[model samples]
Target: MKRNLREKTKRNIGLDLTRIFAFLSVISVHFFLNTGFYKIPLRGKRMFILATLRTSFMVCVPLFLLLTGYLVSAKKIPLEIGNLKKYYKKIIPVLLSYGIGMTVIFAIYRLRGDRSYNLQKLVFGILGYKEYSWYVNMYIGLFLLSPFLTNIWASIGDKKTHLALIAVFSLLTVGPTVFNVNDLTSLKAIFAAYDDNKINHLLPGWWYNIYPLTYFFLGAYLRTYVDFKKLRPAKVFLALILIIFASSAYNIWRSHGGSFQIRLWNSWGSLQNTASSICVFILINTLAPERVNEKIERFLAYISKLTFAAYILSALSDKLVYSFVNANLGSVKESMPYLPIIILSSATLALAMAAGVEFLTEKILEKSVREK
Candidate 1:
């Protein structure tokens, strides 16, 4: 019954697996994006199947938020200058990670002779955080606020109070997102006045942008409370599948057999995406052993560290893998049978490149520090 998670030095194999899977899910989503999965018409079972896969992998970003809450919520950040310094020291590597990632990615594009990123765009793009670095931008804010968020969660008087907070946050963030409609024209024939952003008219959409906080509080809740043994993992797995299928089916139906648009529950704040990430996070922690082989944990620990860099550098792998595949196959539909392999190839390359980049960056930083 340790109250301080920092004191618990042993690794949670479940979290390691979660981190790796989340990074893979990120890469997998790009597989869909680069291959034009969205352009495929929702005709027959193929779109449904592919959409279902896409829906399942859509847990990418939320998983990281939940992981952040679980790992950081129990931190003991006191009101002291030393504590603040220690706190920020942890964030510097992440900042460095993004910097290295953005620079490396920008350089790769420049080297490849991509005219889109000229000298001016390169400076502005990296300074503005670039397109694929949106998650990094979001995470930097969260990381900065996590200490205060931890204080709020830790100050709660009781489990009931924490549950109430979770409920209210859910209403403000998840409710609006899950209940909203993206396409107004499709509904205009029926509702006449319906347009974008009307479905959650009563739910208060002002706070919907803070959905990451909802998942964060959720992870904090699970970390501080919740008995994993009591909740059946089998039931959870079934619910995960059901939610994925239901969400995917809703998108198919909403699309009206047109281009497979992610119209329903495909967002970070959507209920289905939130629930799926939670379910997988819970199942892994509950099912995985308390400890793993030392050798394997060491390997996974290294890989887990690289997952962030791998994610940031994923566009490099995506371009390399998809460019070749698409040139050969002509379309995503024609390459349906090789979807899994293509995804694996892309993910593998990202990890491989991340290993090199992370190692080289570490050595470079170490050398700079030594010189200083």
Candidate 2:
């Protein structure tokens, strides 16, 4: 019993590592995007390294969704009124924190003469609008639809149901990319518009619905069907190879004509990104070795627990950091060389601030909640 318990703990720890890595990847992406780091020319090797990091980090969002599906689905947390209540209790704080935090950031920006607001932007931001906020919105939708989605999984059973759902999801994922009709309402077009206009688009409201439902169902299906015990070393290697080749090929193709927009469209698809995420998932599950997995798992568990706080604080930090740097250093376009340093410094500072805030919230604020 002792040995078995130790082994189980080890495995959970390994899973946590992968999760932390995913979050770090997210941080890296945001760092690059908000800063102009990727634009720098670092001769040949450095340029190649930065490019690889940028491309690989793109998997962060999909990996996050996949993990969400895996965890929630595997736990088989039944969706009920009680569950909904609990979910709202958990999510409401995040939404409220994000709103108040962003509002302050926006107000500061406006004061600095960064006038990019209108009624639409204000409405959307209040409603958790903007690109980075999509995950929050998506999760909210998932929580709201959890009962229906879980029921669908429960009714369908494992094999037939997951397969059927994947098939439908595949169509939903790919259909928008291939066909475009202005008169018709395409999921792809909506997602695209959201990407282009951020809060300015009405279509994001629709696309946000797809994130949680699709991911929740996918997670539930995977939890029901995928058997880590059945996996072998050879199969794991093959999956890894496939993920590498596919991701590399796709990245290369994307380099020619792809942009963030294309990647966003392909995010929901079970193509390279999905394959990569699953491969990492499988690799972590079966062959993570013991020590490495334990370390990663512990770190990720910490980060995952604090992810909501990190996200909220990170956004606020990014805006503030960006505004401060831009103001002090002049326009980023002109201060290109200093951009990377500023972004990195700002991210570090933001992460530290987030950690501090989380400590207070959990220890002090949460204690107050318990007392109440």
Candidate 3:
């Protein structure tokens, strides 16, 4: 048992790093959002550098989506009635965590002087949209469908067909978004004539929002078929570096050093976003050492488990840190040089506070659950 546990740890340490970095990316992305990075005009070499960080960090959520699909694919959960209860039970803790996080965010909002929120508002907020927890809505839909999706994955025995499915999904979800005039900042759209009405109707993008499934299915496909053992880690790393630059460079050119929208198409379906994500996801899974240090493994694993909570809890960190910084540290542009410090401070504070809440939440969840 010990040998098996150690082996699992070695293999998963890379994923642990993935989770940890992904969570950090979430915090960093919020740094841009909360620090007024988006409200200011983006241009010049400095903005390009910041854009690169934004591009790189944007892959965090995609990495998690891919990880979900990959991990789910590795398990053989059929869509049978017998397996339904066991599979669905995994969601109890997620729901509980979200509830706790949501209440905290709503409470903080009230304390921030939004007195319009009452118990009724809080109750409505549970079923409705809450801050920093949009991912929860997307995830719940994906989670409910995973069993059927994985079963569909199992049915597709042909590699060619699987690739074709991914291509189609990408084309519909990512292709139009990356090339349409409706979104002028996209690479192809940036080069072409700018016309909001001149959309590429040939490639209908009505289905672009299904990108969560795209990432999920791609994750499962990579896990099920790709032979990462055969690929050179150096080559993959080089490709990832190039993709990040290509992505950031395009955004820089489009911005023209003024009136640029950094968050536009920064969604999961962006080409650079998708490209960076797949590349990093592949590299991480491929390049991990066979035997990681046990202590490092434990640390990585512990922090990784708290990632979701840290992420949910960042609603508070973002509020508190930025509130203080915006008040004392000067304007967002003026504080550009100190971006690293600001983000680090917020992330550290969030993770520290989330650690205790997460532990207690887990214990409560454990007791609340009754085995059949």
Candidate 4:
């Protein structure tokens, strides 16, 4: 029993460390995206460096979703409503965090003499449209639907279906968009029709982004069906580095010629981003340490619990930080040499504050839950 307990502790440490790193990666992504990183010209190695960071961090959210799918698969969560209710209850913390964050944001804007807030926008914000937490809604849907999805995954019982679905999803979404290989002008019309025909109204706007669902299925499929023993860690690491370099360099090359929208697409959601994300996700899962010092494990576990709060706080605070940086440090273009340091510092500060608040709030909330 003692040996078994140690093994469990060891196994959990990997997952905890993964979450902690992914959370910090996401904070870094938000800082760069919300700031003037994009506004800087693609002139030298600086823009290329930014591209690498962006492409790498783009995997952060997908990594979390993949982790979610892996746990669900590994645990063999039952295809039952009761299990879902337990999952649903887990989201209360997310809702509370969003509410608190948004209220703080609203207060900041009002105090800054910005009166753009209104009833309609508030409703939209609560529903997670036109905001950072839009992924939360899609996540909830994926959580509720996971049992059914994983059921389908089980029924297929083959790698062929997995490859087929991934291919199709890639074709429709990331592949062509990244490479500009296909004439997507007509595809835009299809989406435009979907929008105008009120098809979007059939579900929340957030649900329309199908990447999350694909990622959810991919996660389950990989964890349940694939054998990583054959794949060497060195090869996987090499692949990861290659994808990051190629993707970042490709985007930099595109920026010299592509239109603004085209450049943005290539930089942000290109094939490189998706491929790198997959590599990193697989790399972490396959190669992470099974155990660590007890102190380190405890620290990771605590920080991992605050992942959602860190994400929410960073999202809310990014704009304020950007504003402050612009006002104090001049335009990001002028601070190009120091941009990375500034952005990283802001993300770290936000993560620290978020973790502190989440720690205290969770204690209070869990106490209430226990009392009830």
Point to the candidate with the largest TM-score.
1
> Where does candidate 1 have its weakest 10-residue lDDT segment?
189-198
Model 3: what TM-score? 0.89
| Candidate achieving the largest lDDT | 1
Off by over 4 Å in 1: 1-8, 115-119, 182-200, 368-372
Candidate 2 accuracy as TM-score? 0.67
Q: Estimate each model's TM-score.
A: 0.90, 0.67, 0.89, 0.78
- lDDT of each model, Cα atoms only? 0.81, 0.58, 0.79, 0.65
For model 1, residues 234-341, the per-residue Cα lDDT tens digits are: 998998888888888876766677776654346788888988888888887778777677799888888998999888888788888888999998676777789889
lDDT of 2 by residue, 112-183 (tens): 787886556766776856636767766666666665666666767558656877767655653443332122
Ranking the candidates on TM-score from highest down gives 1, 3, 4, 2
Candidate 4 lDDT trough over 10 residues, lowest sum: 193-202
Total clashes in model 1, counting residue pairs 3 or more apart in sequence or in different chains: 0
The regions of model 3 sitting more than 4 angstroms off are 1-11, 108-114, 182-195, 262-265, 369-372
Model 1, residue 62: C-alpha shift (Å): 0.6
Candidate 1 Cα deviation (angstroms), residue 160 = 0.7
Task: Give RMSD (Å) of candidate 4 vs. truth.
Answer: 5.9
Displacement of residue 269 (Cα, Å) in model 3 is: 1.1
Model 1, residue 119: C-alpha shift (Å):
4.8
Q: Model 2: residues >4 Å from true position, as ranges?
A: 1-11, 35-52, 75-83, 96-126, 175-212, 229-270, 289-300, 316-348, 363-371
